[model samples]
Target chain A: MTSGDRGIRGVDSAADDFVARRRGQASAPAAADRPGWRPTRALSRAFVVIAVASALGVLLGRVDLVILALPFIIGTAVALRSRPTALPTVTLQLGTDVGAEGGDVHARMRVANPGEVPLSTAVLRAGVSPWVRLRQGHGTYAASVGAEMGNSIVVAGRAMRWGAHFFGPVLADTYACDNLFHYETLPAEAKRVRTYPVGEPFSADEAMPRASGLGGTHRSRRPGEGGELAGVRPYQPGDRLRRIDWRVSMRARELYVNHTLSDRDAEVVLLLDVGVDAGTSGGVDGKASVLDTAVRATAAIAEHYLHRGDRVSCLEFGPRVRRLRPGTGRRHYLSTLEWLLGVRVADGVSSDTRLLRSGALPPNALVVMLTPLLDDSSLSALAGLARAGRFLVAVDTLPEHVRPEHDGVWSAHAERLWRLDRENAIGELREHGVPVVRWGGAGSLDQVLRDVTRMSASGKAMI
Target chain B: MNDSRLAQRYHQGRAWLRRTQPGAMAVRTSVYVTGFLAVVTAAAPAIGAARAAGFALVLPILPTVRPMKVWPTALIVTCVAVWALTGEHSYALAFLLGALLYTHHTSAAQAVTMRTDTYVTPEVVTGWARRTGLVLLAAAAASALVGLLPRLFGRTDAIAYGLAGLAAVVGLGGVLAWLVFRKL
Candidate 1:
């Protein structure tokens, strides 16, 4: 299991139980009513030895032997002189509520002693999750605790994967004076942080084919507030005075206003296929699998279009349909990433017509689908999106290094047949006028976008 | 220049060891070996009585030196050894047992206070030493009191000494009962 999954079973399980119990309790459980301080087996053993050894020395007439029992005498004196103390209250806190994958999370636990007696030996053990890689700081700390003294212990570790990772409920075992008694506390509640997948910086200079929204960097054919001159026309009352061309008016003997192409934004819809991942799993540092490529490429594409002031939306069809409605802004981009973190393959494919509660996608919107074409469900979903009369492009996210896992004559034959079927699928997509291209890191979509723009302008736009 | 080179080499060797060996295993191994040597030294008073008792007492504590339980048993056994080998015999066994108690308590506490992946910091070592020193100082004061008790009541009658021993036992018993029953 990966470290992310390992934590779900170990410390997280205890945290779940603790949370359940806390929910079960109608009110706060009284601390004093709980198991009070009692003598340890070690303390009892010391008392037995001191009594038996001292008696034996008296009976045996061993005078010097009495001197040898001094340490036990002192230990007994110390343990008895000490008073029983109430258990301390501990709280755990993380440094931040959000972090990126491969970034560190800092944690601090505070232990407060609210008793009259001081603890000379205090050992605090904070439960750690396996998701924390390269763990630093001592989870186990030993120090003295006075009645008014509270301590803050710190620990830090790197998050190995992107997801909701949990850390906390420090278990504290402490001893009263002379280590005579030990008190243990249960595991605390787990704190979760959403680790977003750090997207690779994407740069695509290609101008979009269709611009739909009111204001953006892309120049639309319609005239509005922009620097690009479309033509000169007779001035209207509502037209801005700054747009008036004095030289043109002087020549034509009438007031003329400068007309420019409106700078408008486009609606970019990204359809992600999470149905099945083919080939070996070599993590981020190694060769990415089909799904890994799809997720990363989706992130890169979303970032690119969003940076250009385009309304971006995502629809994922695997075993379940997950969709984020069209929105624009920095917060919306973060919401899209947070939604993508929940993307995983379900048992079987299912579809819902309410992919957008806002109704069908705009006809002028540019639809980009990311899929490996390994499963027919995603292909069918893509076709449904295209049939809705939206312009579409399918980016093939299949890694270049994919090969059959088995080594045999029949296996080789089957692998060849699979590749042939995939090629046929791609050929069919092309027949429907959906351009398919491999996703390269930068400028991968430039040529296809340019071709689509040319085709759309020539009035032969394909749905 | 030669001294600096030697120091650099020493640092390199230490780093290599730190990378190769795990902290927990090194600590456990060092503790067990040192504990075994201390038990053998404490047992060196004689083979039959002191050695057998020392071996029996120290063997179980070698793996997990539960400082609280192990120290009391060790003190009792050391007292037996001291009484067995009183005059014209070595008193080194008693001193070694005291030192062993200190080392055993400190090492066990350190092993508990740190995780397997982490090493003992210099601050923790200093803390452990200071705590152990305070305990040893108390033990030393009590030993001095024991020595003074004999001198103050020297040449007393058997009846008076017996009565005194009985009173000490009764006083300890009453105090223990009161602490356990009422105060607790």
Candidate 2:
């Protein structure tokens, strides 16, 4: 398979410029602050044609030709009858600024004519990103506003995919009484709509190798209150009556209490390999690309771990490493998702060892690295995490049917070679005791989590 | 020659139209038709009956050309040239040129205001048509009124003075309009 020919640097620069422009527009003054009206070329044409034609007809003594040219004279006179004292103000407002994939948003544009000469007809158009598809019959609107009155029209669209999209510089063309004199506004304000990535439903309650948090759902090996009994111990002064092992005490002729292992929460470190996104991105409805799979898998894994009362921290490594330090709660999940949207491939090799240098990986915490397994840098990062003696699992997010079918048999053979190389990488991680699992959405991580639990039972994951 | 290929190409074309201009088939068709009719109407008086039929061949090319800014001026000049050649006193020719200018201006304005992917709503088309139609009607009424007025053309010095005064008035109006329109 061919890697992406597009450099993320260009996309990043364009996105940055768009964001900066939108920011500037948001703080800009209202359209009504500046009032400018101008005559179009059509009006000038009317004037010239009427004057020249009428003069020639009269000078040449052709009464019929003179009659023919009078309409233009009348049209020009009617067009010039009105004088616009002030420019009309046009403003655009979005119904809601945030949406999910495949969700609709309505943008309302208001054109207010504060002048005495009301606009006879006004056409308003809003430019939008291709990712944000306008719904049928919602592209353009026509309205006629009276003197000192306001008129508004709604342009509705649906967010076809995830990411931040903008609908822009709403343009307006306002005509005077005879459609002669028109006023076109200098680029109106732009609106931004942030669409969050939609994730597939993932159901995985797999066990983690270790638990260290104060509260959780996994059964830990440590002795504590409020769980299944670990053993019986000699009764202490502070022991409650409910904890007394009466049968064991009778057999030993001494007072004893039951020792229970409480279910404790653990820290989950999610390392996202945002080094490269391979394959074609068919968007939401079609096949998921490598990056799409990685992102969705990261979201699903984070959601699963967070739902289990475990603190999940996400680290995306590229030229710059973005870290969401170990956090738990619905709000943290949202913040993590928002961070994932900004993750793009870096230009150079990521030499930043900040993830290991920061010592954010706590003892006994299970680390899961989501990657496409196509880039060596990401695998190297995985190897580094494993070498730190932390329990790590490599979740391969490459789609199984990623090979292009229309490229003939040679491409098929090349795909096989590439797959062999990827397998060798996975095998290398496995030889270092890092388990690899293919992401299958709902139960993708179950088997790998079970393996980690078993290895931890043998004191391998912790070592 | 293959049936499947032809069918696929046809479907692809349809899909492209739907993608670029969703739900705008009727409105866009109307614009094209109006543009062609205006051209045909303008040519009728200028070229006479037989030659004007030949002008209809240029109708197909109009949709393909980028709406040029010089279209209105060129079309008005064509009408003037036709009147100069025929010296016919037909207001119909003037009406035709006026219609062409009106539609061309509106089309260009719409193009500037919207993206190519945007849909052209029927309401916008109908609204512009109604406004332009009223202006045309008003101009026709004025033309009829002017036709009823007494003839002023003669080989006399008084007539020449009158014509000169009219030119002076027109020049002044142009200057005043320019000043007012330039304000921001």
* CAPRI tier of model 1: incorrect
* Model 2 superposed RMSD (Cα): 5.2
* Model 2, docking class: acceptable
Predicted candidate 2 versus true structure: per-residue lDDT over B23-135, tens digit per residue: 23443444455555555655666566566656644542444243335554565566466556654545565555555545554454344333344555455556556766676
Interface RMSD of 1: 4.4
| Per-model TM values vs. the true structure | 0.74, 0.84
Instruction: State the C-alpha lDDT per candidate.
Output: 0.63, 0.67
- Lowest-lDDT window of 10 residues in candidate 2 chain A? A4-13
Compute the DockQ of candidate 1.
Answer: 0.18
DockQ of each: 0.18, 0.30
For candidate 1, what is the TM-score?
Answer: 0.74
lDDT for residue A198 in candidate 1, whole number 0-100: 58
